[model samples]
Target: MSGQKACCHGPGYGTPLDAMKNGPREKLLYTVTVQPNLDEPHGDYLATVDVDPESPTYCQVIHRTFTNRTGDELHHSGWNACSSCYYIDDNAKQIPKRDKLILPSINSDFIYILDVITDPRKPTICKIIDGDVLKNHDVTAPHTTHCLADGNIMISTLGDAKGNAKGDFILFDTKNFDCVGTWTKGERKALCGYDFWYQPYFDVMVSTEWGAPRMFRRGFREEDLDDMTQYGCRLNFYKWSTHTLYQTIDLGTEGTAPLEVRFMHDPKRPEGYVGACMYSNIYYFKKKPDSDDFEAKKVIDIPAKLISVNGEKPKALNGMISDILLSLDDKYLYVNNWLHGDVRQYDITHPENPRLTGQVFLGGAICSDLKNVEVLEDKELKARPEPRYVKGRRLEAGPQMMQLSLDGKRLYISSSLYSPWDKQFYPKMIEKGGHIVQIDVDVVNGGMRLNEDFLVDFGKEPYGPTIPHEMRYPGGDCTSDIWLANDGK
Candidate 1:
């Protein structure tokens, strides 16, 4: 914290718009990368990449910090404080800065607190709250980590200690990272939980479901989709102040696996969007007029493609929209289709109708073996596009996770979804490892093109083949932040 400029707001730019206009450009990226298999001798770790173009080590992973345990399966990471705490009365003293990161293991139930204040580039582990601690609270399989308006941190838990589908929220102190008990007030009503978003101004919180730990730990099975007990297809809405589930909207089969939920960047607006991974669709949700609760409608749908490999019978493959995020300015929404190998940019100036402005393919099942594969869409035969190559190397794996720069000029993407899912859908990714690529965004015109010169190949690291997951910038980013101020403030 010596050289870092002090912020008047709690820990981030005052508002999403302020962040877009005033936030400094990112010089380094902190990424979570896991080994090829779950049984690695060395555990999953955080890899720091140099993003500054002028730096000598630009586009290279300069540092790696490994966790103590071997099989943690580290996923979505969050900060201890952000712009959301702007309204805290004593925020200047209670939340001095946003230096600590809360990283949770979806498999082991362990939580690691990392201190980046000493050095943002090379963060060291300050504390590790073991798996049993969370089990003691009757919650395991921690997924999303978020900081509330107060100094406390709230995380969404996917299952009970026995590995059953029990959706609950866990709370912990910001200073000690000690268990403050479950956040939900009464009995757990949600069948399962995955991702969540909150808007305090409207007193609303929306969470999506994604089955239990036992159902998806090993790998994804097609039969699991048919079993209601194994997979989830509903969205749960909660009262933000009371921490109680108020309503649930069943998306049916077409909206199975509603994974990531995102509210608009404007804190005043209650409208948002969710990505359904299994069904290949995006559903828009908003507060019903003259009501406190909400309703959801399907706004975008991607047709599944028929794929055949090695002269086998054609199989229908879903696009598998793994991740989505809105630009800080909230003018465009970006979505990635993991199976179809395409990242699409949609202009959402009108919240109800999204217009497609740009699209690009990386690599996926359809592009796995271009020469020997047959691809069809709807009822007509279609030719698969040639494989994408960057820096003379063929790009493998589809875009699974994405991070947009605060300025909305550059988009960063990682190719690995989860270790188990990576092995099932793209086995080659396990052998060669996942990679991170950069896509230059045309902010003025709303289009995207691959930046061929910038690439971070995890397969070439000192450690054996590893897969990169989620990413965050040292300063706040588009996906990891929420603003409490209204637009045009």
Candidate 2:
């Protein structure tokens, strides 16, 4: 990957800081790093890093970097090679070390601040925040972070405490990285799990939580089998100024288990819509003009059985709907059924009622690799389980993360298990290798699907690992809302 020149221009080329500081000023490049579990050897935690795009070939690729409230730099480096830790000096020599800071557990929600760094090159350890701040606050384990339009940072906390499982939102001073204030949704313990995304166009942030009442029940055991009751998902609207919860909609009522919320601005739709995955249904909520509320207008139920390639009833589908994406043209919506191992496209000609127009199955009889491992001795474990097989269909691995090309012409799909912290905790699943399916999108056919022409073998890389969390488009416009400097220049 080193010899290939990045598609975008080299960093630090056109920025105003070109002549300011000493050598080249470093820009934060976020890349998710998976830290393999030494105990089970299969589970790993995903962490992010900031790298200087123009640094010499020999500079160390970073593990983590963040600035405290006081503007002090904090950094974490030096994980083992199996963990994919490496150095890139001017000579590009690969030196490996095990001294890197390893978190106490593999769950994604275990730590508050995993690692931080102020300087991209030669980063230093800054400060670690305590988790006690969430004792009675009903905040979740790991906080979802987003750098706001202002200099402040917004973190969404999922409430998994002894009380109600409902969640809250917190804001921090980016300069010092201190908790400034929080946005609570009344007094009910709401379960706001996983993540929240900001929709700047509407001046509001949106999040979805799987409302499971049993999660709040005492003595809840992992092995307990119970009816999965949908508590109804939430679409929270916040007033950016006061950091207050302005309005919310019960998304799960329209669709079961509304997990992911994505914002879309369409030229045809009077009000933009939020697409959500509710079990076997797809829902869309359109925003009210100049208001913090949305009208739940449309719900589309996916057909249970597609005429299989050989024309048979599709198998039972179970699992969380991981991600939903809209093409640049806003004509179609792509939904990934993680457990079902299928990616489908829907036509949104009528924004309120999208129709499932296309579908493709990449796997069958899905079983999580993380849930299959049995911890024998401290340093050893059993071989990962193979895909579950069923008549006329074999389980394909789950699709965990996906991203579209800027032009929206191609889709990149990845198959990996959930973070090690989830119920199933297989760590080394990535070592068995995963598949990257690239599909062409038909923009002309109301966002219909084109044939998949390429499948990249990521496992063949020299130090290949199990999971690849994100893809970085180097030298792009850097317009992501997380970037503090995105003026669209």
Candidate 3:
């Protein structure tokens, strides 16, 4: 399909490569910025940034649109429609365009829908899904949002209406943005939910676990690991068509708090990786060769660094593998160590054995040579590689969220993780505000370098210091777009 013809349908491109080759170049990006402090009641907002280097406002936030209320802690955002539901027949008229964006608040449980097509530079709030509405459907703490192939929307909620640690998926009609009740048929077997991905060809859907909202929203407590009800360390597999849980895999001690999950872009492949935050490990999973079961193995392990904490000497600090994603071509994998303050790229051509190819430091607590580090309730001394700088601005807060370009040439990253966790890990960075930077990819040779020419410092915004979370492009990005088996035709 020609690029021009593909743009007329939902999310356009028929395959990941097609999108990378023919998809439109990103000129603007919409990122969610949160006001972590409650005393300053200004509220979280969506920021519009000019990414076009040729523009006069290049590398600057051009506009900001706030959510309905304060203390929302806006986390992730996605489109209402994507290539998952590309129109194949005359029903193309009935299929919605890749326009509106669904932004969900992890703290307040509110979902804000924005009209991006109207003005890509400045998105306006078209509709807001109140927390009460989700509570009525027995779910809250809305997290990951993904467009379904059936012309509807599905979001993974961290808990039930009261936010008490139960994985329940909430559905909504894309056309009207109305709540369509829970996607789980009956009792949800999973204890927690954070990120999820589906592959219709395999008839499988995989989801990872996080902490209960009631506990996580307050802050991170090391003692919570002992309580099964407060934290989780398992992955749930479900039948995609029926949305029924069939199997559950316990990741044990080394896989505590499994967060992000990603499958290969190829529709026919059934392999992916999940990053375990607590233990700093990545597990690769795939279907059993001759059976109807799936198996996972620990393929990447990040060793802990010893640091002083609150006058105590020699304490092990986990890397806190916060986010992970695959390149559009599935040839490389990127991992972000929030606490260690570095991003590492791996060559995943062999799937099980991921070879570290490139690594670069941005902002992190342990990545510096300073003797004293000030985070909440801890004083540490570290002697590691000096932190890297861009355009004379010292990058603070380690890399958190990432979004890669379709063509696999550039990778964009944000620094803020979660507000509460950010307070515990990098409190000083919170006051200084979050930032967005670009990394030029060595796609051919497997490496990455900081694009010193580009930087979006949220600290400089007129709306006070804010922490930016997830980001999405006006025309679909590598993370937000998915292609079906028959989409290429």
Each prediction's number of clashing residue pairs: 0, 36, 0
Give the total clashing residue pairs for model 2. Answer: 36
lDDT of 1 by residue, 1-489 (tens): 111224434678767888999999899999998876656667888899999999999999988888957889999899898877654552256544688988899999998898877988889899999999889988899999888867789999998898878788899988788889998875647888889998878888899989878889978988877777557899998988898898999999999999989999988889999999997999999999989989999999888887777789888888899899999888999999998889999999997899999888888777745667777554422567568888887777898899999899999999999998888878888898789999999998999999999899888767688999999998778888888753322
- Candidate 2: tens digits of C-alpha lDDT, residues 231-326: 436666665445556676765444544655555532123343443443456667666876667676446554332212223444333334656766
lDDT winner among the candidates? 1
Return the lDDT, model 2, position 39. Answer: 38
RMSD, every candidate, angstroms: 3.1, 12.9, 3.3
Inter-residue clash pairs, candidate 1 = none
lDDT of each: 0.85, 0.42, 0.84
Question: How high a TM-score does candidate 2 get?
Answer: 0.59
The window of 10 residues in a row where model 1 has the poorest summed lDDT is: 1-10
Ranking by TM-score: 1, 3, 2
Any runs in candidate 1 off by more than 4 Å, and if so which? 1-8, 90-93, 378-382, 486-489
- Using all chains and alpha carbons, the TM-scores for the candidates as numbered come to 0.95, 0.59, 0.94
